[model samples]
Target: MSTITLSSAARARATGRHFVPRLSWLWSGLFGCLVILNIAPLIWGILTSFKGQADLFRFPPAFVSFTPTLENYERVFLSGFGGNLGISLVNALAAVVLALVLGLPAAYAFDRFNFPLRRLLFLAVVASIPLSIGAAALLIPNYVYFASLGLTNTPIVLPMLYAAHQLPMAIWVIKGTIEGIPRELDEAATADGCTTFQILRYVILPLVRPALGAAAILVFVGSWNEFVASSVMVDSPSLRTVQPAIYSFIGFFGREWGPLTASATLAILPILIIFALFGRLMVSGLTKGSVKG
Candidate 1:
């Protein structure tokens, strides 16, 4: 029996040692495939941006053999894409600020307080997340309502709409983070004669910095990439955001692939820079927020 038990344990250990390397290889391969899928288009877009109009339609799609040009970038800038970029930056920043300002307090209220229909309200907020994915469906109604109120084509509308669209998700993210924190901290602050606002400002805010960073990234990205609402809500070129501005490269006749790709390449820079700088904070916040205390 002892000999049999020893042999069985050895076999199990050997099996595990073999299995672990295979499992690791499987996961590594899966991750590599995902990276390719996500990054190939971006690489193609950047390469296309630098290609001349003639090089764009080359046989077999020139990955490296084509002569690159700066004309597309020049055209993009000369066409006032710079202004559109600025407008998008402003709108995205405004939306992030507005969403955070409103979301943080609302999240705290939902997590820390009990009121009439509180559960219902929280459910509604969660439901709204799915509904927001169908923003195209709401375009006509939003346009008509805004047009009636003389808010259409205004500078402020996109920021406000972006904020409203992202607010619920922001609240959800922040609330999840808040839930991970212990109530003992709030109680301790209260015992020290801290008011609700003071407690939140000094204690809760410091701890939930990661979550806030994550929420801001989400809101900023959403607002920056928004196209349908930006297109319908604002008519003036001066009020146009980046996505719609890029869409203008498609005309009734044909598409200008060079400038289109160039604009797209330029448009992604801010987001890339942001992610490069604060990605760690965002990841930390998201991971920490995902669990409850």
Candidate 2:
């Protein structure tokens, strides 16, 4: 019986060693697939931007173009595309700022206070998704309402919509982040004669930044890529954002492939760059939020 037990234990150890390598290989394959999935589009976009309108529609897609030109980049920078990009940047930045500002305070309140209906109120916030806004069905009335407020065809409206759209998620993200931080830090700061405002500003804000950055980046990308909301609400030529810019590229006459692709590249680049720079923080924010939820 002792010999049988020893043999069984040795067999188990061998099985465990075999399983570890298999798991490691599986994880490596998954990561490689994720990287390739993300990068392929970006590389394809670059190639398409270089390709002329005809080359883009070739019966069989070709990895190499016969002639690549700078027209796309030139049109993006020097042509009317520049203004659309500016508007997109403005909209995205404003929405992120608005979302963060409102999200932080609301999240703090929900996290700390347990007053009447606290959980109910928190649920209300979470339940209010964009679908509840009824934007598509309410376009006309919404326009009339906004016009009454004198917000029609303005950048303010985009940010306002984006802020509202992002608020629920942002609140949740910041709340989770703030909870992870020890309360002792706040108590210690207060004991050191820090005011409520000072304690929040110095201690809580710094600690919660990763979550906030993650929230901001998400909101910014949404706002930047926003199409229906921006197009429906914004009517003025100067006010139209990147989505409209892309639409304009494919007019009734013909699609401006090069310039359109170039603009697309530019539109996507900033968010990618942001992701690259703050990768660890984003991962932390995502993981923490998931675990908390």
Best by the TM-score measure: 1
How would you encode candidate 2's per-residue C-alpha lDDT over 4-68 as one tens digit per residue? 99999999999999999999999999999999999998898888888776787897987884588
Q: For every model in order, what is the number of clashing pairs?
A: 0, 0
Model 1 regions more than 4 Å off: 1-5, 131-134
Query: Candidate 1: worst 10 consecutive residues by lDDT?
Result: 127-136
For model 2, the superposed segments whose C-alpha errors exceed 4 Å read 1-16, 129-141, 187-195, 286-293
Per-residue alpha-carbon lDDT of candidate 1 for residues 120-180, written as tens digits (9 for 90 to 100)? 9999999887533447888898889889999998988999899989999889989999999
lDDT of 2 at 231: 83
Q: What is the total number of backbone clashes in candidate 2?
A: 0
Pairs of residues clashing in candidate 1: none
